[model samples]
Target: MNSQSPQTVLSGLRPTGRVHLGNYFGAVRNWVRLQEKYRCLYFVADWHALTSDYADPSKIRQATFDAVADWIAAGLDPKRSTIFLQSEVKEHAELHLLLSMITPIPWLERVPSFKDQQQELKDRDLNTFGFLGYPLLQTADVIIYRAHFVPVGEDQASHLELSREIVRRFNNFYGNVFPEPQPLFTETPKVPGLDGRKMSKSYGNTIPLTASADEIRALVMTMFTDPNRIRRQDPGNPDICNLFQFHKLFSDDATIARVDRECRTAQIGCVDDKKLLAEIMVENLRQIRARREEIDRDPSIVWDALREGNRIARQHASETLELVRKAMKIDFPELR
Candidate 1:
């Protein structure tokens, strides 16, 4: 065994069904790489999913399974990193309830996403207790693992601050039971979908990470290009083209430079450019698709991995809960 003690990192994703390119470049890929360097814990935040979709949670179970499969297919090794469902741990809820007692109501209301999500998801009735306390639950998710770092993009840094504050308050009140987890800011590239908008499932423009080659081709072919360049011979600006943005991610430097020059010189048409991108994307997704297929052939593989992860996660969570209970003088003699 390696003698060096690895720093712990924790991160979770709400089981939102399909994993798309936006999710890959924005977070999941980073999680895969971080696992190689850190003691990582990744979970399907199924309870968090209820913050907004509590009305119809029939899909959460399937979404959790699919999301786990996507994470595995994207190179999150079950052996290297703890992978489990948040709800299965049980300790998270207990910690969340305990933390809620100390958390200020105004702090929950001030979280940026709380209002933003409410306005964005106007159709959903988010004026509920679960939605308000989502950040508190997230705080519990990080601190329960005593994670040293929580990998997040800039948009999520503020949310992590809430976790830090919660930790500070908890330690102040209950006698230093947890560490404040700092944000490990990661570079999350802007991934655009077919309509030249930020890639999102709600937009119906996503190219799912597990999509077949034909599906990839079909989606890529529909991606928006330089709208002003109406003719094949018309000069186009690669900087203004959504397809060019994707090329930057999937194509080599030489291919990108050539595309940039050709598009500007009216030497490459949007149709041909899209076709080239589709081919490269198909090649890129080939290995991931193959792995997903293998996992799909035996569904037990994912479940068994998650079950093992749940056990390991429970062990750590139980230890943390014991400390928490002891700190709060809630560990009754009978229970002990």
Candidate 2:
């Protein structure tokens, strides 16, 4: 990635499905805030989605809309950020092809997530060129925006390292057109699902951001609480309760303290505690739902925004690609 002020940041999400509360607090909130301080490029990673779940991919189109809609509603300002789609810009694929030539096979083979996901999705046949080359595409996505920083969790640090190494190799051969991007680590909270597990769609344990008030209420009703406090009269352990964790995020600090005090003393019953959490969740979601409805009504707004973004992305990426072709001696004199 090329960095102008050395503060440009790029990151993206695959258009998989409806984002959940976990997604909101974990990644989207950070992107929303980072846009104010940094040069930001946020893209819908529709191409990356094909790495694993290429089969039955008709959902990608709908999922992309839902994901982008949620991003706009969650305060990602398009005026300050370059929001684009990966497939819309052909330069990304061109850069990916170029980077793949320089990227060693062992480098891609050693990507931890690649192998882990291959085994995890063993039911599907993973023997494909696209599956192995997705990380190279990821590198292209980051560098095309000339991003100096990539916000990621601890687990993703290795991929950033690999991208840095690829950048070094490319610069060694070609002229210096890209910078080695670094990780901007974020401390994402442990958001548990209704099943007392990590919130994930695969586990059928996500609370959808667009879930109706009644649906959220029903899910909250089934939320797991302290197992030791089976009886309403029994003293509960808020420390061990997932709903308590949620309360800490959604409820006022004073209410959280009271919930802690009352629960440990057997004053607040589990049912009432869950009901209170449900109310807070519903209240917070009301504005998000309204924002989404407004955006949905004018579907052209998203398309128009994306079209403008594609224009910006193509211009920026073409500049880099032109320099790359010159460095690699691919551009002809007549073409130039």
All candidates: CA RMSD in angstroms?
1.5, 1.9
lDDT of each: 0.92, 0.88
TM-scores of all predicted structures: 0.97, 0.94
Question: In candidate 1, residue 10 scores what lDDT?
Answer: 93
- Model 1, range 1-336, lDDT digits (tens) per residue? 145889899999999887999999998999999998999999999999999998899999999889999899999999999999999999999999999999999999998888888888999888899999999999999989899999888888887888888899999998888878989999898999889988988889999998999999898888889989998899999998998999999999999999999999999999999899999999988999999999899988789889999999999999999999999988898965
Range of the 10 consecutive residues with the lowest summed lDDT in candidate 1: 1-10
Relative to the unseen true structure, what is the Cα RMSD of model 1?
A: 1.5
Q: How much is 238 displaced in model 2, in angstroms? A: 2.0
* Model 2 C-alpha RMSD to native: 1.9
lDDT at 229, model 2 = 94
TM-score of 1: 0.97
Give the winner by lDDT: 1
Estimate, for each residue in 1-336, the C-alpha lDDT of model 2 and write its tens digit: 344563888989999778898888788888999998998888999999888788878999889889888888888878888889989999999999999989999999899878887887799988899999878889999997777899998877987888899999999998687888989998677789888888878778889887789998999999989999989999999999988999987899899999999999999999999999999999988888778888889887678778888888889889988888898989998955
